[model samples]
Target: MFRNGLEPWHLLVVLAVIILLFGSKKLPEMARGLGKSMRILKAETKAMREDDAPAADGTANSTAAEQDRPAVAPVTPATVTKADEATKTNTTA
Candidate 1:
């Protein structure tokens, strides 16, 4: 009969068993990984919710168009090394 559900001592025993199985050193690393995964999941869900919300203009099609656009990285001027400049001059001749 499950009359009384999970007292403090029950949780303590569970914690003790986990510690024995995993040891104390690995627990922190596991907890840190779990925290990071939770944060990434939360961010992704928030982004999805935002994407699902209707725009102020009441246009749902605009969101799809925006997603279709390719992301472009900014272009920077290439730095020319002395060796590259010398090679260029040799090739031009």
Candidate 2:
């Protein structure tokens, strides 16, 4: 495979083109824009990682004691049935 890199000659050509196209005065402005773009990208990437990390490592996040307990009490139909019966009885009567 072709080496994936800009040789010194390539870099020199690029720098010459940039300097010719944009005078030295404008080069500072171009560099400022590039730096701002990089900062924005870095912040967004970090935020994405933080969001994904919580979901990815959620299982490991629970406290040791919490992990030992059942997730929730079994939802027995009888408990709900009694409440519904009461509500219906009151509504009808």
Candidate 3:
């Protein structure tokens, strides 16, 4: 479904015009240029896909590496409870 609504008659008229304007000798060169343009666009899109792919894996490692960089640990619930009990017993109100 081309959906552009073009039909066989349109193709024949276009072919006839191309034949008259550019002639047979230049048709091969035009076709080759079209092929090269498609290849370049495909390659560029592929490279973008590859570049985006690594970030998904890299994000995990990057965050893990950050965790190792400082005195970043926070006291847990059990430790806080123990500390509170010790403080209360020692205070002896």
Candidate 4:
């Protein structure tokens, strides 16, 4: 018989359970981290939206964004010679 789906006491019980599970001392740290994460997410979403918006001078934002980002070297598979493989095998053995 779940007539009153959620009352004030129900919320209090849930809060009590959370406090019991993650102690009172850790709650503030968790809350602070959550707040920081939310702020970062908001900022990233704003930046993405700005990047999507067209410039007034008809220039693409991609060029500017690309310039701001660091270039990473492309990863290529390493070619192992028989000598190298043999050295690895020797070391392991």
Candidate 5:
């Protein structure tokens, strides 16, 4: 049964302790870093939520767009062998 948890004075004391431990000069820098990290995290979560949401009658168009894209050529062992040979020649010469 915790009543009146974390009053204004409690926050002020915590802030004072933090300021004492990190110093006034470093506090702004730490706050800026925290703000930047929070912004990045917010942006990523927003993007993830958008991706999770279903497209509105656009699935067919997306499938068509995907089909229109050119397929990637597969890498072969011969191509890798050639690349290795070229690197070996350059290193030795």
Candidate 6:
């Protein structure tokens, strides 16, 4: 039967095991990679939220750099069908 759920010593044991398995140098590299991955994930999620927000409110929420760049048209099913038809006609001809 377990008397206590978790103790400081338990954490120390886990840390010791991790250090032994990964070594000191590898742990720093792993931690750095993890930090980068976390930052990238946070940025992507924020961008997704920003993208959804503009669509929902029908307002442009863009930077000056974005405004200066030419807008790319989104592909639609109708456009795909038209393109396919054009290709087919060209192939037949």
In the range 21-85, model 2's lDDT, one tens digit per residue, is: 99999999989999999999999999777655645645544444776987796776663457878
Pairs with steric clashes in candidate 1? none
TM-score for every candidate vs. truth?
A: 0.62, 0.46, 0.50, 0.64, 0.51, 0.58
Q: How far in Å is the alpha carbon of 13 misplaced in model 6?
A: 0.6
Q: Each candidate: how many clashes? A: 0, 0, 0, 0, 0, 0
Q: Please give, for residues 9-56, the per-residue lDDT of candidate 1 as tens digits.
A: 999999999999999999999999999999999999998898888888
Better of 1 and 6 by TM-score: 1
Task: Output the lDDT of residue 91, model 1.
Answer: 100
TM-score of 2: 0.46
Q: After superposition, how far is residue 36 of candidate 5 from its true place, in Å?
A: 0.5
What is the number of residue pairs that collide in model 6? 0
Residue 79 accuracy (lDDT) in model 3: 34
Candidate 2 off by > 4 Å: 1-10, 55-93
Candidate with best TM-score: 4
For each candidate, the alpha-carbon lDDT, in order, equals 0.91, 0.81, 0.81, 0.92, 0.85, 0.86
The digit string of per-residue lDDT tens for model 4 on 1-93 reads: 789999999999999999999999999999999999999999999998988898889986675768899989999999767988899999999
How far residue 30's Cα lies from its native spot in candidate 6, in Å, is: 0.2
Q: Model 5 over residues 42-61: C-alpha lDDT tens digits?
A: 99999878766668965633
Pairs of residues at least 3 apart in sequence or in different chains that clash in candidate 2: none
Could you report the Cα RMSD, in angstroms, for every candidate shown? 11.2, 9.4, 12.1, 9.7, 9.2, 8.4
Query: Sort by TM-score, best first: what order?
Result: 4, 1, 6, 5, 3, 2
lDDT of 4: 0.92
